[model samples]
Target chain A: MESLVNPYVSVDCVLLGFDGEQLNALVVRQSGNNGEDVAGIYKLPGSLINLDENLDEAAQRVLKQFTGLSQVNMLQFKAFGGPDRLKNPEDSVWLVRFYNLNHHIDRIVTIGYTTLLRIDRKMRKLEGGYEAQWMPISELPRLAFDHSAIVDEALKAVRAKATLDVTLLFDLLPNKFTAAQLRNVMEVVLGITLDVKNFHKKLAQMPYVVPLEEKEDGVNHRAARYYKFKKLKNKHI
Target chain B: MESLVNPYVSVDCVLLGFDGEQLNALVVRQSGNNGEDVAGIYKLPGSLINLDENLDEAAQRVLKQFTGLSQVNMLQFKAFGGPDRLKNPEDSVWLVRFYNLNHHIDRIVTIGYTTLLRIDRKMRKLEGGYEAQWMPISELPRLAFDHSAIVDEALKAVRAKATLDVTLLFDLLPNKFTAAQLRNVMEVVLGITLDVKNFHKKLAQMPYVVPLEEKEDGVNHRAARYYKFKKLKNKHI
Candidate 1:
């Protein structure tokens, strides 16, 4: 089995995006033997590593191929390996069809890389026929193999980083956003509603996240003050 | 070369311990052909993974072999790989003899795991002939291969975890300790002098780390009150 596979190393990308209202994941629909979409199940964008490239390079390649974007801020979060990780009956069946792995080669040790991207015009303008779909993280179905666990760990990493690095929020938000919009994204990630006044007060204390003198326009109700995050001289304390 | 070598995954353990005052790292001395200790150079305990074992199992195996202890709390921190990681001229020369790698295969990707052990009676009672040494992390000299970078990353993870998990300090200290002692450990780990009054005030707020009715005995000055950490229902918030 070892002789048959090039190298058992693979990379999975948990590409997270912010869509104003909810946090989303870029998952691809699985394809069957006839190249038809398998309708129900989806998986993270991933691929076996080429022997020529390193782990980071392989991760970047997979991210680019799936999202049609380069220079994504991907982080190598963890490596997942277990004897039966790939041999789960359903997962192996898919592997046999898609990857053509021999029955004996039933395990692959995959590195997990995660990145957050804004749901901007380029993301919305993805080419036709691409099998990728933006699924809200709150409503993600069971993913292939151990990818569900990978996404869980990536979310943990992001949440931990958010408290220390303000730039993560900036990357996920629009150039100018109201304080409520900022708090909503954090609430979505944390799965808990924060006290609006307290949350805004905390944001106000930050040297970054500068408030604009102007108020939001084109809204039905009263206008709200806008804010933009400024780059920190040092990202972490 | 691929056919000649086992699966290319390796595990390096950054075994750390605290000896009351300073933080120390477990580094093994590499010996040359004639059984002479290679003068000042040292490395973390590491080995290639067995075909049958997963990454965590491989890490445990290596940690046990080097430390002669079990039930070590090990965490997989990172995976480091590049085309030239193992191809350093001096490092390759040493690997050629020590690991007996096939001359053709010069690169191996390694996963890094870190474990913190209490430097108590058992640790002090190890047999005299062990090649491993507990060198203070601050005073550590340059290590072999890319191990120094691994140690740096492990320290970063530990420091980050310490801020969130007070139980980590319990693992490094005795069953009962003084507030000053606790503050000293945190100071060493963070490399800063914490305000004694403020530090103790914050600790007082935590339900855990309960103050004990006992006090330090036989000290020159007034004895300080001792404290014990209570097990939390859940460690992480």
Candidate 2:
């Protein structure tokens, strides 16, 4: 099928995943004009929206095409479309060659979407021409095309939502996760080392977090009690 | 200067204003193809984005042109870019004439921005060719161009933020507002009547809400004490 390029609209995905200990993001390594790998250059998975496609479909296509993952819940956070969003010389070079963006079509506005995943649960592998990696969000390199700012905004959205809704934490943990693992995801996303007493105190108040009968298995340390999020029927909060 | 219209890009504003007793929205009356005023047809303020303009600049221009207001803090919340967004017969008839959209450039994607304002405090008036009104959100008409859905999402964003931050209430109320006025705004926005005892109990716990040594004057009913939001200088929520 011919690519129905609109040149003015695109979608970018910030996939924040967790591996039990740290927060990570799925980023694709952008290559230079010579098809040579550029060291330390990564970007959030993105693509130009097709003329006939919806924005959400475009976002899902970008996620699946880059990370080989599907059926993930994504939330649209913000739109980043400053005129100078592509003024970086390297970004211009990459887009002009790879995306067929000419001078007149360089000022594209991109919609940003975010998703949190349990990377250790699925263990999905990347399978595309673009080399994708799960890099720690804390140690992120300078990204291309205003993506670092996009990631910052996505992180803010995640942190803000995580505070009110315990169900969102389930996206970053296994079916049965330790309280420490849940607290670690919150702390890492909120960028704060929460007090041990205060953290458990807050969790105890949440009726949605149900303690399972089973505990952590086969770990070197003491087995911690596991908990899972229970959806409250007909409750809107 | 020319329009510089990028047919595939546009800006839509969901300007939610509070009018003391109720939450309201600024809506423009959309016209018919023959330059006749379309009865009962309203839309959120919107315009085609200029090719040389940033998304934020485009949104500000649209808001200013429609409402004669500027310098308000606005947030880009979502992007709506369905292929058939403008496929409705009435929407197409209006846009094809006003926007010069042809067959090749019919699918326009719009970035939705939201801003909450104190209508009584500013008293800003609409000054444009199209008639605009501050309609109560509870009695909103069926809006054009997927705007009702956008307004719903904006309300959700405002309500979600309001629960965590008392400072957001200041946008809807005057500097020295009575507790009744404050609770009315919250009740209207959240679409639920908060219990008087429970609401004040929650407010008492919020250190940010400082009770002032003043009372509401020139009212038919009994005078009520006034309060204002006091941000902690070195504290984080």
**Largest DockQ belongs to which candidate?**
2
How far off is residue B97 in model 1, in Å? 5.9
- Residues forming the 10-long window of minimal summed lDDT in candidate 2 chain A: A1-10
How accurate locally is residue B56 in candidate 2, as Cα lDDT from 0 to 100? 88
Q: Comparing to the true complex, what docking class would candidate 2 get? A: acceptable
Candidate 1 chain B: worst 10 consecutive residues by lDDT? B1-10
Runs of candidate 1 with Cα error greater than 4 angstroms are A1-7, A31-40, A89-106, A127-130, A164-167, A196-203, A234-237, B1-7, B31-40, B89-104, B127-130, B196-207, B220-222, B234-237
Model 2 residue B98 distance off true place after TM-score fit, in angstroms: 2.5
Candidate 2, residue A79: lDDT? 89
- For all candidates in order, the CA lDDT equals 0.77, 0.77
Residue A73 local lDDT, model 2 = 72
